[model samples]
Target: MKPNASSVSVVRSVTRSAIRDVTRHLRGVGLRAAPLALALTFAASGGLRSAHAQSAQTAPAGQPSKAARDEAATRFKKGIDLFKETDYAAALVEFRRAYELAPTWQVLYNIGQVQFQLQDYAGALPTLERYLSEGGRQVPAARRTEVEADIQTLKGRIAFLDVTVNVADADIAVDDTTVGTSPLSKPVTVNAGRRRVAVSREGYTPQSRVVEVASGDTVKASFDLVERGANAASTAGSSGDTGSGDSSVPQTGTGSTSGGSGDSGSNVPWIGWGVTGGLAAGAVVFGVLALGASSDLQDLRGTRGVAASDLQDASSKATTMSVVCDALTGAALIAGGISLYFTLRTPPSDSAASAPRTRPSQATRAPRATWSSASRPQSSGPELQIGISPRGAQVIGSF
Candidate 1:
């Protein structure tokens, strides 16, 4: 049933009395200069009716209907009651709901008041700024000055973060609260202290960084996220050189066995033998060259017409080749002994039986996305490397 003129007048009168009482209570609590007072003052003086009437006439196509506006008014009154009861948190929630139901600028003022009362300076700063921007000339000059001063105070207690991300549509969060998605339109204001900012996307590895900022400072943070598949591919490529030739092969123990048997791994017996064989071949080639040089020297010495310089040259060549051949022969013997030792070493029977078997498919596989650095097992046992040049043969390894 539609309310009669007398009931409407009584309701308005009761609302004005409640506003006056709340204003008095705020003064007693040292919140005399609060935006709450300004909000209640305007609301008591028919400001809400004027704004609502104006909004209804020029309401946009998607604007809330009359029922939504009525609901918003109910929620706004509930918020004021909660605020009077000192339940600022509950008040903030109701005010926020009212703003969502009917996006009038006045609710923003109430929201900022509740936020400030709750000591949510970071949240209040933006809310009040938005109130002023939306309210425009509708907001009285005195009230604007008061809200502006409150904003300055809020700025003194909070900080700003200009977060940037390489990918679009990535979610950005500050201290676990989702602020916006990448390409964030503006800087995110937060309480002054250590804050953890995280960025995540569907196809990329999530990234997070902790940063500290003082109040009123503006800090810039950048994130370059890597695609999940690409990161895994890069890791696999880097570990490829260090990976075992056949993942199916069972690894042997590298420690010494107690019973005259070697627990030490063979250290790739075939490779050691191959290097020894190559050194031996090199020795034979140098020996042949030395022999040829010596034969040339003999021929030059036997011929009377041979130049002395030629004989000297032949002798020098033979000496150099002989030295190289001897060096190569020595290297071959050392390499052969090392290869024999490696081949003779056998893992303990217990170790061989206890060795874990890994399938080829399981060896190179990794998580598509991860927050930690990639890790790979190191190959055990002494590594033997051998190199041969025209100068001589060189062997590097631990016995």
Candidate 2:
């Protein structure tokens, strides 16, 4: 009368499914039972150890195959060892696997302990509560009270974020660290303080919010991400995913150019080149004036019976013009040097340098639009609050 292999497999599948449903129901509010709570749950249904005994008494030996039970026990042992080693993450995985096979409260307890050890208090709270609820008589009344008290104390230090997200499978991040996907099982627990929450998904704009929560308070942060204005025309031309197809990208180059030095450089730096050209022109003009005044002086001195006053006047004029010419020449040289330096030092904005280059794709692709992200609190209760954006620099520019 022993149950066959097929029957045992069927029982395990059914039990796993039932347990999963129960787990999901318990977690509908966003938490789960403690790892050890499985012991009580299993015991209430004729404790996990009593499972085979009940099966044997009802029918025959090996009702639930010994090998299967032994494997579950082995997994549980490994989980315990991992927990002792302070490898809480590994322990949780092992305990979960054991629960899948046997679905014991003890495994749940272990999982909860690991979560707590890992400082995932928000995740741990629900599981521990579940353990207590189902622990029933298996947990001593005094012990249950102690655990419940602990749960209450833990709640005081934690704040809850009940997030509402529109996009399915969108990742949610708390304080820049990815927490989980959207449609959370329950409110995410975090330390009381200012927290940043964000949600993102493909083909949709990312949404984020900042909120301040006092200890024991619950806040709402909801995300309704918008779909991108996907355009194939834009994607084909974009160097990166963010490129606007209609916009012409600046080509990068090296060295600088000045007026009349045409390599298709737009926006002539008149402030630099104009000064250089003007100073050079002034020097030439002054030199010509000085030479003419000196020539007049020579003519006045060479003329027979030339007046001393006329000669003296021409000499003084020549001297004055020469000094002015020399001063201008020096000024021109200095001005020219400064202009050359500035013209050669083209700012990066004007220079097309060895910037990262992107190629236009021939294949049709979706073009992104000017995307703006906003969030609000989606709540049915009075505690529901709107999304609070963190203080940030405002970027304003023309397209």
Best-matching candidate per lDDT: 1
Question: In candidate 1, what are the lDDT values of residues 54-159, reduced to their tens digit?
Answer: 5536555887766676677778778878877888788888888877887768778878877887888898888999999999999889889988999889989999
| Candidate 2 lDDT over residue span 33-75, tens digit each | 3333354344233333355445454524534354556567667
Model 2 bad stretches (over 4 Å): 1-68, 166-186, 191-196, 208-212, 230-399
- Which stretch of 10 consecutive residues in model 1 shows the poorest summed lDDT? 368-377
lDDT of 2 at 141: 71
C-alpha lDDT of all candidate models, in order? 0.75, 0.62
